[model samples]
Target chain A: NAGVTQTPKFRVLKTGQSMTLLCAQDMNHEYMYWYRQDPGMGLRLIHYSVGEGTTAKGEVPDGYNVSRLKKQNFLLGLESAAPSQTSVYFCASSSDSGKLLSYEQYFGPGTRLTVT
Target chain B: DQQVKQNSPSLSVQEGRISILNCDYTNSMFDYFLWYKKYPAEGPTFLISISSIKDKNEDGRFTVFLNKSAKHLSLHIVPSQPGDSAVYFCAASWGRSYKYIFGTGTRLKVLA
Candidate 1:
């Protein structure tokens, strides 16, 4: 069913460059999130959206911006890439608020971004 | 300040043995905890979860135990198989927050 899919599995960018990572989910989840994973560092939240047309800052949102214009799509943008931003980025979605349901996150394959 | 911590960076166990992975958290407000498994080049997948109201939750070969007093949680995999070799992450959340604090992750290698 293609639960969650991320475009551009791999990408490389020079310092100061910009790019966008696309995440699409077919589960029709209301919550979507962007996270980065680095060696010895667990997944850190970059940004998240509770629903369409809504976005909020997460744990580490310094160099990233996100948009959830559509219910099924969440876009994460790197305005200016930096060496510290080079890491594997993951997109996840959950059905609802962290209440009745356990809010289990379903993740995509992930996008590997390298900034030189 | 990392809230969720996985003390062990990696663990190796023989197949069919019980594998226990430990996790601790500094935040006392956390009410929900979960475990996720990840393979090389793939994203983390949810394995199981436990609520603060409960001390333990089990699903097939996986079990999660939460100790609120100590702010500790663990994932136990019984009869571990080679296929269980992967990175395991522990995450915690409080109330309605959509964000979860995740641990550094423990790489489990189940030797056959």
Candidate 2:
């Protein structure tokens, strides 16, 4: 199983450019999440979906939006890129909502985004 | 506020020795704790986890000990191998929230 895979391994955008980072998982997980990792900082949640068509904001959701149209796929969108959004983005999925079961997250190869 | 914290930024241990990594959390609502390992340019991988009801959980050479009273947890790897070298992150989640709070990773170097 590919487990979890992310598209556009690396991206460079000028301020105001819009783009989407795609995440696909084959694990048949019920939960999906988007997180960004900055240097020397812990990975922070941006948004998540308990199931398809369900979305919720997370700790650091500013400048980012997410869509989970299909259970196997989750997309993170940056409508207007900013220098502050330059960081490594990660996508994860789990078997359950993680509240009642193991919250163990399987992450994908991160997408490095740079805005200048 | 950062709920999870790995006080040590880095730790070095000789090959074949025991390596202990520590983590602490500030939220009492957290009922589940997890540890993840990451290599350069890669995302964090789930390692081991311990529930609040139990103080210790073991899997192979990796063991996680939770001291709920102190709000501290530690990971112990015995006979550590160089391949175990990586950045370790601790995370916590509650029973009602799906969001997991992560700690600034602690980089471990298992010297050969």
Candidate 3:
């Protein structure tokens, strides 16, 4: 079974362009998250969803929007891409058993997005 | 301000030697700590974790030490091997929630 998968492994977008990154997990986990990684900076949370039809803003959710329309898919959308938005995006999922401190999070390979 | 901090950007150690990666957090409310290892072009993977109530936890060659009073934690890899080389990240959460604050990862190089 594919634990976690992200679509569009690589993409390049010009400033003011828009795109969406899709993340799908087969684990049927209740928690899904989107994070961006930059040089010297660890993964920063962009957005998260605890369950389907529920989304919440994370630490760095300024220029991103997320939708968890289905239980297995979490989508991150860039309404207006900026140069600063160029970074590797990672999607992760975990169970919502209230024991996340012990359970591990499954992550996708990541999508490399370059905004020029 | 970054609530979690990894002072050393990178570390190098000879094979079979001990490798210690340090991490500090400013928030006292953080009760759960975890360590994740990532290879180049891959996502981070869970390595080990420790609860605030515990001072130390060990699993095989990896050990995680937590000091709640000082808001500090560390990961120690004994008899480091070349395969152990990777970017190590320390993350903390306040409770059972999924909101984890990660520190600037420290790249560990194990020389063979």
- RMSD of candidates 1 onward, in order: 1.2, 1.4, 1.2
DockQ list for all candidates: 0.73, 0.69, 0.63
Sorted on TM-score, highest at the top, how do the candidates line up? Answer: 1, 3, 2
How well is each residue in A15-94 modelled by candidate 2, as lDDT tens digits?
A: 99999999999999988999999978889999999999999999999999899999999999999999999999999998
Each candidate's iRMS in angstroms? 1.4, 1.6, 2.0
TM-score of chain A of 3: 0.95
Q: Which stretches of candidate 1 lie over 4 Å from their true place?
A: A97-102
- Whole-model lDDT per candidate: 0.94, 0.93, 0.93
Weakest lDDT window of 10 consecutive positions for candidate 3 chain A: A96-105
Ordering by lDDT: 1, 3, 2
Per-residue lDDT over B5-87 for candidate 1, one digit per residue giving the tens place of the 0 to 100 score = 99999999999999999999999999999999999999999999999999999999999998999999999999999999999
DockQ of 3: 0.63
lDDT tens per residue, model 3, A58-106: 9999999999999999999999999999999999999855564544688
TM-score of the A chain in model 1: 0.95
User: Which pairs of residues collide in candidate 1?
Assistant: none
Candidate 1 CAPRI assessment class: medium
